[model samples]
Target: MKKIVLATSLLLLTVCSAQAQIASAYAGRLQSVLDSVGKRFHIKGLSAAVYRPGEGMWTGAYGESYSGVPITTDMYFPIGSNTKTYTSCIMLKLQEAGTLSLDDTIGKWLQNIPNVSGQITIRQMLNHTSGLFSYTNDPGFFTALNSDYTKVWQPEDMLQFIGAPDFAPGTSWEYSNTNYLLAGLIIKKIFNEPYDVTVRRMILDPQGFTNTIIYPAEKRGTIPHGWTVMTTNGPLEDMMVSANYDNTAFLSMATSAGAIVATAEDVAKFWVALMNGKIINSNSLAEMKQFVSINANNGYGLGLFRMRPVNGHVVYGHGGTCFGYLNENMVDSTNGITIAVLTNQDSIDNNQIFNWVVTALHKNTLQMAPLSIAGNEKADDIKIYPNPASNYVDVNLGTANNAKFELIDMTGRNIINTTVDGNYVRVSLSDITPGLYLARLSNTEKGILKTTKLQVVH
Candidate 1:
C-alpha cells in the first residue's frame, strides 16, 4: 500500500512538473499579447489569465491603474455582465438543492413592477427569453443615477425605470438587465439574506474564490482605478481619481446583474471550475448549456454566451461592461482551455482583446508538450512519443482502455483515425502530409481523453 501511494505521489509530481514547464513556456507569449493589446488601445490598465486543464495557468498584467500605479494580478475590476453567470449559477444550485425550480414564475417572488409580468419563468429570465425591459435603456435612469453617484439604489428602486416588455414571456429573446436584477431579488426572497451573501456562501467560499466579491455590498480596498468617459463621445478619464466620482450608483444598480468585482485570475478560475463541474452538478451544467440561438455564430444560454469562434475553438463564457471596466472570459468547449481578459478602460472592444489573447494562447497550446488525462485520472498515465515523426508515433494510453486515436490537421481535417484496445497504439503518419497536426485520444464512453499537437515530418 505504501509503495502504491509513493508511485501515485511520484506521478503527481511529474504531472505538476510538466504543467509548470508548459506554463513557464507560455508566460512570455501571454505577456506579449497583453502588452501589445494594451498599447494598441492605449488602455489604462489590463489583466488576463489563461488556464489549460492538466497543464497550468498563466496570469499577466500590463499598463498602469492611473499613471505610475502599475496594474497587478491582485487588482480588482467590476466584471460587468459577467456577474450574470454567477447569479445564474446560484439559482441553478438552489434548484438542485430542491429549494426552487427554474420553471418557477417571477410573480412568485417579485411583483408590482412597471411592465414585468409574473408569468416570466426563472429559466426564461436566466436565458434572457423573458423579454423584460432593461432599466439601463431608460435615459431617465441615468439622469437619476448621475444625480447621486454615491447613492445606493435598491433592487426595487431600479425597477421603476423598467419600460414595457419587448415581447411576451418565452416568446423571443433579448438581453435585459432587469431579468437578472429580479433573479437576484428572488434569491434574496428565498434566503431572506442579501443576494451577495448567498453568492459568497454558495459559490465563492466553496470554490476558494477569495479575490472575487459581489460589488458595493462587499468591498475590496485594493481595487484598481477604473476609467471611462464622463459623457458619451468624450475623452476617457479616470473615474476613480475624479472628484465626486463614486461607483456606488452604477454598481448598486448593476447588483447581481453586473456587479461582481474580481481579478482576472479569479475570473478564469471560476469559469474553468464551473465548466469542469466543480461549481455545479452535471445536470445543472447541462441545463446551463441549453443555448437559444442568438445568431449564426453566437447563442444565449443560462446567463452564459455562446460566443463567436476564437481561432476555430468554440468557447462559452460571458462579457461584462460597466462604467469603467470591460471583461470577457471564455472556456473552450473542445479543450477546456479557459481565458479571461479584463481592462479598466470600458470604451475599448473587449472581443478584440479577447480574440488576440486567445490567438496567442492557442499558439502556445500547440507549442507545449503533449500531456493529458483521462476522466479523473492523473495525466502522467498517458504518454505520446516521437512527436516529430516520419512514419509513425506511439500513443501509450497507460492501461488497457477502449479509446479512439486520430490525427487531425490544423484545418480541423482528420487525417488518421483508428481504435485502440490495448495499452499502446501506433498511429500511422506514412500517408499523411508533413505538417502540424493535432493528435486526439478519446475514450469511447468518457469522451475526449487527451489532445496534443503533433508535427508530422517527411
Candidate 2:
C-alpha cells in the first residue's frame, strides 16, 4: 500500500509537469516570433499572452514597455481598436438592464442622429454594419490628427467629414468610428451617465477588470504616443509622433470606437469572462454571437467579427492599431484559446506577424491535442433528429453499451457530458443555447463518438 501510494503520487506529479510543459511549449512557440522580431526590426519590445480553457495560462512579454523598462504581465499598453470590443460589451450590459434594445434607432436618443436615407439599427452600430462614412478617411481629419494631435475632437466636427452615407445601413460590413461613436451616444442617453462612468460600471467593474482604463489621460501625465516609421532605408526612421496612449484621454476621442489600454493578461481575462458568460448573461451573449452576414467576404456578430470561409471552424476576434503599438488578438471560444499580440514599433509588417502568431497558436492546439475517438465509431445510421435540436433529440446509440456522451461547443469545451447505456439516449437541450455544438459519443478505451453539431432555436 505504501509503494502504491508513492507510485500514485509520482503519476500525479508527472501529469502536472506535463501540463506545465504544454503551457510552456505554447508560450515558447509564440514567443519565438517576438524573439525574431527583436533581431530583425527596431521593434523595441513585444508582448503576447495565451489563455487555454481549464488549462495552463501565461503572458509572455519580450523587450521593453518603453525604452528600457521591461514589459511585464501587469504593465499596460495602448490596446487601440481592441477598445471597440469593450464598447460593444458595454452596449450589451445596458441591454441586460432593460434600458435599451438592439432595435432602438439612433434617432430615438440623439435628436441629431444622422438619418443617412437608410434605416440602421443600434445592433448594426456595434457590429460595424452601419453604412456611415468614416471620418478618419477625410483628408482634413489627418491634418487635425497631425497638428494638435491630442486636441479634443467634437462629434459635430467629426460628422462634418463623416458626411453622407457610405451605403444604405446594414447593406454591408464597413468599419467606421462613426458607428461606435453613436453607440457611445446611445449609451449616454439611455444610462443618463457620462460615457466613462457607463463603461466603468457596465464593463470594467462587472468583469473584475481593474486595470482597464477608459479616457486614461487627462493631460494627467506623460503618456506614450503612437510612433510610426516615416521611411525605411537600410536604417528605419521612426517618426517620433504622439497620439495619446492613455486610454483615459484617447478613449474619449475613440469613445465607443477605438482606444483603451490594458495588459495582455487583462485582455485575456476579459475575453475568457465574456466567452464564458461572466461579463454578460448567456442570453445576451447568445444574441451577440449571432452571425450577421457582413458581405460575401465575411460576417459580423454583435460586437465581434466571426471569420467564415468555405472551410473549417470559424474564429471570432478583433484587431487593433495605434501609432507605436500595432496589436491583434483572437479568442477561439470553441477551442478555449485567447491570443494577444503586440509590437511597440510599427516599423515591421506588424499585420503579417500578428496573423502568423494567431495561426501558429491555433495550429499548435491542433497539433498538441489529437482529439479524436478511434475504432470506427461511425454513427451515420444512429439518428439525432432535428439538426438544430429544439429542447429534445432522440439519439439512437443502438446497442452501444456503456457509451460516454457529451455536448461540446465549437472550441471542444464539454458542456453537457455524461455516460449512459442501452439502445437509445434521449438528449435534452433545454439548457444549451441556440448555436452550433457537437453531440459526442465515446467509450472508455478505443472509443468512438459521433460529432453532431446541434442548435437550439426557441
For 1-458, candidate 1 gives per-residue lDDT tens digits of 00000000000000011123235656666666567656654666777777766556777787777665777777888898999999999999999999999999888878777798988899999999998888888888878887998888887788888898899888898999989999999998889998788999999999999999987898875777777666555556677676457778888888999888998889998997787678898678878988898888888989888765666766788988877677987876656678887876666556655665555656566556554453565455777778788898998887637677877655333466677877687777788889988887765344467777888889
- The digit string of per-residue lDDT tens for model 2 on 1-458 reads 00000000000000011113235665565556455544444445565667655444566665654444455555566677777777778778778887788888776666654544335788878777778877666676656655654466643455655667788877777878788777776777777776767777777887787767765332222233334444333232223423333233334455566656776667777887777667787677777777667665456677677764312555667777665666677776444457776655554453554555556556566555433334444456556677767888777765355665667676434577655667577878887777878776655343344556677676
Off by over 4 Å in 2: 1-30, 37-44, 65-67, 113-118, 154-157, 217-225, 231-251, 295-297, 308-312, 347-350, 369-458
Candidate 1 lDDT (Cα, 0 to 1): 0.76
lDDT of each: 0.76, 0.61
User: What is the RMSD, in Å, between candidate 1 and the native fold over all Cα?
Assistant: 11.6
- Worst ten in a row by lDDT for model 2: 1-10
